[model samples]
Target: MNRFEYADNKFSEIEMMIAIPSFIIGVGILSLPQALASATTAMDGVFSILIAGGIVTFITWAIAKFAASFPDTTFISYASLIVSKPVAILLTFLFAIVFFSITAYQVRKIADISKQYLFDQTPVEVISLTFFLVIIYAVSGSRVGIIRLNMMFFPFILFIAIIVVIFNLNWFKFSNFLPVFQSNINDYLTGVNKSLFSFGGFGILWFYMAYVNKPNKAPKMAALGTGFPIALYALIFLACIGVYGESVTASMLYPTVELAKMVEIPGGILERFESIFFVIWIMAIFNTTAMAFDITVLAINLVFHHIPKIKIIFLLSPLIYAIAMYPQNLIEVSAFETFLNYAVFYYSIFVLVLLFVVAKIRGVKPSE
Candidate 1:
């Protein structure tokens, strides 16, 4: 691909497939096992994980098909058709807030995790500011460039994750998962709600689906993209419990990183395996942060057609950093996450459902 092609388009289904999981496997997975572990009994979290994954995967497919119905159309263009221009613009602005909030949440969470595992001396404010600046730089360029970065970084992230799970095999204790299917309705429901939020980023397809060249191919590819992260999450969740019983997994802040610390190579050449893991892990989180912020900028640019993307980046940079640093402590950060998750979780379902309902009411359907 030449520079023009790279800059102007990435309408391939394959690219969309790669982009979904690359964006979804950010800071959420680090704390997933801990969150799930706390919500259920032995091995019961798997049910929630699978149930939530299935739900997200199906919705991803439905959403892609919805967007693919209107070929070569941007989200706002079709939204304006279904709803009036004013309502669509208002929805776009609201979406900008949601994606911007995602950027802030990822920044803050990554900063907090890095302080605990990678940078003890560094202040979280410094870490968050630096991370957001890097994201700002990435978003300043082409959107295709951000997708290309995901393609490059995804392999290392997946490789490191698989290695971590594999090496921790010896620590696996089947007894840890023995008391299966014992949880009550309420326990399973709580786990389902949390896991559903963990699988949140597939909503990116609402915008990106408009880019797929082969509309017919998008729904399946979207489903495949979401499936990869679901499988990864389940494997890591099981591995964490197997290594540390549910009690221990729930007690720690980041059980996945703790799992990394237990990994040792044959030669002991690099004593700190987690340090390497940390480096690769940042790449994954960067993919998530960069994409969310880039889309935020894109949404704003869509509304303010006169303003260049660079200016939008500069304008939103401070606001992003301010939100990231607003959480004074981990408790506050958790509170912020809970708020953002619900906002994202319900907002995603709401948009898709609203589109479907209004479309049906008005007798609008996907073009053949």
Candidate 2:
């Protein structure tokens, strides 16, 4: 990752921009309403989501600007200049570990959900292995291919999400907002901390922005890309409370998917709407896993310079599988997810801020 080598597959700021939501909107959205419901009352979750989104957006913009400042250089390279090489290398390894952990978490989550909804008879291990295999194929390809995949899948994801929200209008009860803002600051703070992980994809900006054709435009476009999901999640939270009420939403596992279940086509053409939602949502999850695992590969490559990229993927595949299968039941799975949320919060927010402040104090300027 310290190498400044740029391949021919550099992308436009637009592509980089769209990749944000493509990464941010995956597995997190499926269960956010439930998490928010338990933490905040009524429509108050909307404020928590907005507040978390704002925090993520600001950090994404600033860190992207900082990463882009070094132009053509990887994050590790610039960090080594600001802090010593050994420290930068350690930081990169930790970054890679967090990404790897989240990748495993996403793999396990998809397998568990798919088994519940789509493949009741199939083993979770089988589903997770198959899913990770495809991600391996993706990571083995050109990096731009992953970004292009994000671009292709994002529109369908967003369109389906919006359709779910719009079709659920009949279920809305305006009285849901009657108890607005009833939650105290602690509730809002708790809710915001819980929801912030959904926007954690911003952490990818450090490595990804190094490939943007126009680094100067990185911050604005990154923020704009994230804006889409912030609105989408807040709206989905509102739709969940509106359609199902706060108590019911809190009781359910996947309220957003439930919203899809309630959508009836005008002509009765589309039955089992949640099926389509699951299919498209898998695409979103794929984007997340591929980008994250790719970064894991990049970070490992930085350490083992002589080893090939394909070998790294092969070496890590079994470890990810083991981690995915380690969670025996729902309670353990939830605990594992909470661990990831904290890992991501620390790396994405705290680590990025540390890098930014250190770079400034040391007066490390970007290459002209």
Candidate with best lDDT: 2
Report the alpha-carbon TM-score of model 1 versus the true structure. 0.96
TM-scores of all models? 0.96, 0.96
- Residue 37 accuracy (lDDT) in model 2: 97
- Show where candidate 2 strays beyond 4 Å: 1-7
Best model per TM-score: 1
Model 1: per-residue lDDT, tens digit, 313-334?
9989899899888988989999
Compose the digit string of candidate 2's lDDT tens values, residues 1-368: 44333366798999999999988988899999999999999999999999999998988888887788788888788889888799899888998999999899999999998998899899999999999999999998889889988889999998999999999998789897669889999999989988898888787887787788898988899999999999999999999999998999999998888899999988999978999999999999999999989989988887777999989999998998899899899999999999988888777677677777887899877767
Error in Å for residue 233 of model 2: 0.2
C-alpha lDDT score of every prediction, in listed order:
0.88, 0.89
Model 1: how far residue 216 lies from native, Å: 1.9
Error of 2 at 21 (Å): 0.8
